[model samples]
Target chain A: MDITINRGDFVGLLGPSGSGKTTLIKTILGATDVYGGEVRVEGQSIAERRPRVGYVPQLETIDWNFPVTVEQVVTMGRVRRGWWYPWQRREDRLVAHEMMSRLGIADFAARHVRELSGGQKQRALLARALVSSPRLLLLDEPTSGVDIKTRDEIMHLLDELNHQDVTVIMTTHEINAVAAHLPWVVCLNGGIVDSGPPADVFTPDTLRRTYNADILVTEYMGMKLVAESPHFFGRNERGSADSSERGEHVHAASV
Target chain B: MFTPLQYEFFVRALIVATLVGGLCGLIGVYVVLRRMSYIGHGLSHAIFGGAVASYVLSVNFFLGASVWGFVSALLINLATRKRSISADAAIGIVTTSSFALGVALISRFRSFTRSFDAALFGNILGITQADVIAIAAVALLAAAALFVGYKYLLFTTFEPEVARFYGVPAGWTDAGFSLLLAAVIVVSLQVLGVTMIAAAIVIPPVVARLLTDEFARMLLLSVVIGALCGLGGLYMSFYLDISSGASVVLFSAAVFLIALSYTTLRSRLGSARWRRRSAASGKLEPFH
Candidate 1:
């Protein structure tokens, strides 16, 4: 709940379901009312410069069968900066085409968006987000339902964008994936329970505190991973966890 | 067609049909795509109150209907803005109450010459030159709005949340769309009638959707289908001595059925061909 994301930072938000991850994002978008504080960007209120933030929503937010071409969908991102007319200008179309080609979706520019696969759809959304050249990009579960290969490709694309000085803030449930790749991670459950490098925060104590369940955490190739505690299978009572059992759980939780 | 054009009434009817058909069809693309087809029914009924009020006040029917239609649309939007009332519920409450108010006013105004039957069912032959000009002008305005606001409309229709995030002026676009929808419904009420106007607003675009996946092509096809249905239906009604509205709706239905059958057959045949090719190539069929 209390954090500062510096410019050009790539932060991955990790939380369990109903842990206010989405609510936090919505508050950042100024879509939800914040009673006690203000959300500011570059010392200005978020409302004053909201257009500088690009958002790639979850796939379910779009209508796949909508009667629009991929090029048209991407062209929509230019609304804030493009010509006042509804039709995109020649140069605008060229810009959109270039962005699509960069995203590797130029081949399907004329095709209906419904014809796209899951990764292609995400890329198309990403293309739309980048068409406006925002300073910060926010995504809601970009890797949900995608294959591992596509997820890695999307993460690499985000990292590449970050290298270009475009900040990225994404909410993801993939603990190990974010742990392995992202430099900053924040675990949230109603509030920020832990925040630091993945190696420091993704331990048994933080996982249990954030998830409210016994979990096993391990590391491979210097990247941490988390799984549900095996003792959780039979031990439904929290009172039954003895001190020795808790110690064993932590040992198993962190490798 | 040649014989019908000789008479002034038939000519007026044909001109009106062409204009109304094209207008409804063009607007119907948005209606069907956004799944807001109920606006046609709701606004047509809401405009009836305005027509009856026109009769009582001796005002121009178009002026009264346009005002009432626009106000009713805004009211529906207002009710929906708070999220306290569902869109359909708002439409139902506002439109049905306006319609009931019209009936009540009509019952009180015994001196008014315009009959309720004419308002509810429409009279194609009753169109005058002034009516034709008004309809033509409003249709032109609607067309122009769509032409200039295509991207905003498409964005809002497909993804309003994202559109708003990028400062797409979602509020203005929605208000403009609601006003346009109201105008189309009110104008078509004279030809398609209050009850059947929604069909004209829905059928053509749906048929076009069956034929193409592209939006621009679908818009063109919907207009073509609408204009053809109007001309063919009006002519058939003249020859067969039937209700022109009913004839037009039936013609649209027949066209829809044909498009449906063609689309179904094409997809089936396409899949069968794919399956045969896969078998010939010794490839396993992927489980859907």
Candidate 2:
């Protein structure tokens, strides 16, 4: 897929499980090798320029049992600065403090990271990624396990960061969370099934092609949402409501 | 304390202990944080075969052990990456196989000297000035590696995926860390020997964790605690006529227990004071 992310755009990668959303984001961050296509950030190939890319990985991937404080966690973003000095400058610490406060996690700065709630931990991770002040921010499944309120809060935080002109590119299973807020959307399953605005790409035909399951797309409160039918074989009908309530249900059905 | 020759040995032992202890404490922070403590045990024991091979060939023991350690480290890294075997299983495999190899090598040498026993249990009194210099060099290199890779190391230790995403080269970080650990193992073999060196690497950091929440401060405290254990162990060996290596380990364990108890008591007292203050202000809430 050939796509360009501008300096201040908030782009959401929307796709089902096993889709190549993560691969696309990883390619852009230069974490995954690109075989044929090119991923350019700020008119330069990521492989050539090696631009600063702040990444917030899915929280479930972290081992919370590892003992570390919130401040120490946030300070990890500045690791690429230099080798001889390990200490963060006063300005770095101040910026971390500001980021923590911005994320509403200032009270938990001195607390052990394992003691944080799910939302708080997500915010802490986001704060850590933001401390480096990268030109581009890439997040993988940022709201995968979060509740609806927390998911909206996280998206709002990203929106605020985007307002500050930090380019945001996030891959998430939570399509409804981005349908109303994100400026651009890419729906992919192994390859780009469709790419455009959320309203344009989140169609019944696109959803069916992406997930290989019969899905129904409906409009709720001026927003597009996917609903998988109970008659569909192998589809967990019970999970749809729970997932939809969490704003993460993306339904695609095979004919 | 008064004899010149005895004092020279004592000073040499002190220098060796400090160098080994300080480096172990410093690097042990990363090991403990990364939850790779078993790697210490695995590498220390695996180097025994190399030590025995050196003895058989009449070569420098440090060089032999380092070669063995590097090989074992590389093998462990490769096996863990390539095969589906868990880290503990890899450690078990390398340590037992190498230890058995060392034992078999020792059995082949029929001279039946006390040097083999010394290598197993370690004899701090036998520490030479040359050993002290070698230990210092190893410690210096370990310190330099830690200093240069401190941030990346911290990043990898805490959030490896995120570190990789930021282009921190997690693979190289792990390899560099493993190499540093092998170096520590080789140097520590002088005083801690093949069998007991893992304790020297572990106990101080475990004890230091009780005293501080900050990583940097914890490192400093561990080093101090390790140095004291080494010095006190030597003193105990001289005065009470105990095994120096065992005495050192015992001193460190004792420090760990004391620190644990002290921290527990302090926290209890502090919580009690907070409760009393809150109760006096009529703002105390009932415990759930």
Candidate 3:
């Protein structure tokens, strides 16, 4: 997949499981072994870009009972290029404090990350990623395992971060809830199937190839919504909703 | 207690046992937290092989045993990380084989003398002033490394995968921890014995965990609990005519039981009070 993510681009990687979405992100981070093409950021090579990039791992992968306060978790990102130490330094603590305050988690700085609400947990991870003031941020399923309100809060935070010229790229399973709202989407299976604005790329042809399922694509009030037709056992015999339609379901969907 | 203090050997044993206890507890926090408690047990058993090898070659115990133990520690760590072998299988294979080597060497060379018996159980009564100094030195070195690598240790322990992105040298940290853990086990051999050392390393931290949720507090509490256990155990051994290592481990077990009971009872009482409040209000609501 030969694709370029410009400095200001806000892109969402959308695909089914085992779609190489995360591997691509790790390839960019230089964490995985590569046999072929190179990954470069700006004028620098792969190794140089990893320190400059911020990555938030999947929430499910985190050890929530780690016994660290939000402040400690935030300052973890302050161990940038050459610095490695036992505790957060004075300036690192200040930077962490500032970042926590900016994320509206200042009040919870001393609280353990385990005690955080779903939204606060996401924000804490965001604060940790942002503490280094990276020009680029990469998140893996930031909205997964969160409620709708929390997901919206996370997306709003990322949008705000992107607008500030942070250059956000994230891999998400949330298609309609997340990728459809983004300005750019990369549909991938084993490789990039297509890439464009959501409205341009979210056609039934492209989504089917990416997801290998009949995905219902609808637009409501200019927002692209992607969903799967409900499988009704008896209703399937009445008429396969997908069977009757080539592109009719796009218009057939109601508000 | 005061009469036992008058004996120089008793004083030396006391000092060495206390230092060893605190050091094990200090390092044990990482072992227990990382779910690598078996590493401590496995490494101690492996270090026994190193001990025999050192004695056979007439090498300095610390130098030869440390290098041997360090290599074994590294091997166990590497094997576990590869994940080709299950953690228990890896530990069991490596550690038991190494221990068997030591047993074979001991059985083969009958020249390897009295300390071998002490190594199995413990020989605190036979402790020397030099042993005390060695334990203190190892304790200091472990403490200094922990102090310097505090953040790295915490990050690696808490989040190994993510810590690397922020520039924490996770591999080096793991190697260093393995080396330190091996050294602690080796030095603790005389005071706590191979049989009891794992408990000394594991129990204090575990008891502390039940008492507090904070990491720093847990570390401090573990160390304190370990030191006090050491002191109390030694006194009990002297008064009750028991083995020092056995007394210390038993004391630690007692503390763990107390902590578990206290936390469990506190939570039960708290829930009962909350239930009373809900019944009075005639509605389900949050206790807080």
Candidate 4:
């Protein structure tokens, strides 16, 4: 649908699988055909400018067996006009090293991306995205599957980048862990259901419209937390859910 | 080696083999990384169909075969652009159909199959001065294209979907690469043979992969290894009176076995030492 993201906006897109979250991200990156309307940076045509969008894709989409080092992946961001020659210039290497150091992946520069831990691999991909220093950054499920500590680290890094005036937009399913803390979020299902501060946009009706299922929301320490309707989660601490009830829970969760 | 050089035919064969070796290795990096290994095998056979058609039409073999193969490859590229059909499926569909056409034509002109012996299994003895120049010309074209498009190639190979996000002209890259692949197959027909070309293209890159974790090193190593194997196989063929194509592939296979053994042992020893160090320091294993 129609949306406007201002400079330094730290926005999260929340939606279910196949709800066009990743497709919207691809549309922004010009990876998909723009049939009806145009995407612009400010008022200028994106085509007029050089291709410099920074994208951090989902880790699940990566091929870990591919032979690439941290250094190599980072320099991949600089695959633009200046790289007409085969080898990387001294400045390319310097920029890659600087980005890696900033991301705390310098120690793993020579290591294969395959050998890295989950968070470390995310950081490597982040370093590659940021090496070009674009004004905008788009991440697809950046914090997905990460432990709490690693997730916090990555969020803080994104926060730090946002404070420096880089517009950050990420699509994620971790509504509680990630989208809850975002300054703004869009609840999307093919089109924008609603968008505002998390407390305002993450309403039960909006979430149900987005996920096609009832969801539970609560506030803790002034932050809104979301969970699947506990009627479907599992047995409570006291084992209240019966065997048939647990089977129902599994089916509901699958849905 | 010195004795073979005295004969002009041997010298021509040696030069063409070396060039084809390097070219195949260079392209093999992309082929293997993209998991399009079968395209090399399939496209070479498809190009053979074009070669057969060229003979019947009284067209220049290189020109006709290259165009036909290029068109076939582009169809495959376009077919897989949406990724509805996997790379293997696209290659198989196009290659088999094209090959079937060749078979149909051959039945009509029975004499055509006689000439195809050189193409099917390679005839290093048939390499002429013109073949030498054609192979070298294609090699230069390939080197220039690779040189200019190195970053795009690496980015595309590493992440095909993301490469488009960064302004890589994916369609053009695929089409250009298809043309190069067609030319490579056409030029290599006299030396590597259609049936054996896939092995030449696969072995060098795979061996390089086993030896290194770095992409740049793998690229360089594959080229060097391919060229050396080409030279070595030619020497062996001269002495052993074996098919040069077979000799080259057998040499590459031997090298692959050595590399596989070395890497496997290194990884085992490396893990063992890592375990020992972790126990000594009472630290948990870092990698899961």
Return the top candidate by DockQ: 4
**What are the per-candidate TM-scores when only chain A is compared?**
0.86, 0.84, 0.86, 0.87
* Highest lDDT against the true fold, candidate: 4
Query: Which CAPRI tier for candidate 2?
Result: acceptable
Better of 2 and 3 by lDDT: 3
lDDT score of residue A167 within candidate 2:
87
- Candidate 1: tens digits of C-alpha lDDT, residues A1-255: 578999999998888999987788777887776788778877788766664678899998888998889998898888766546767777778889999998889999999999889999999999998988888899999999789898998999999999999999999988876544789988999899999888899888998899998778887787787764545455546557555654544344211
Candidate 3 chain B worst ten-residue window by lDDT: B279-288
Tell me how far the alpha carbon of residue A200 in candidate 1 is from the true structure, in angstroms, after superposition: 2.9
Q: Where does candidate 2 stray beyond 4 Å?
A: A1-9, A16-20, A32-51, A63-68, A101-117, A144-150, A163-165, A188-193, A208-216, A227-255, B1-8, B107-114, B167-172, B264-288
Cα lDDT tens digits for candidate 3, A212-244:
988788888888788667765764475645555
> How close is every model to the real structure, measured as TM-score?
0.90, 0.82, 0.91, 0.89
Docking level for model 3 = acceptable
Residue A224, candidate 1: Cα error in Å is 2.8
The whole-model C-alpha lDDT of candidate 4 against the native structure comes to: 0.86
Model 3: CA > 4 A from native: A47-50, A80-86, A232-255, B280-288
**TM-score-better candidate, 1 vs 2:** 1
lDDT per residue, candidate 2, B1-288, as tens digits?
A: 545226767777766666677777878888888777888888888988887777788878788888888889888877877458987899889877998898898798865355766677678888777777877887778877777777788889887656876668798998888878888888777677666777878889988888877777777888888888887776766677766677777777788889889999999998888788777877766442
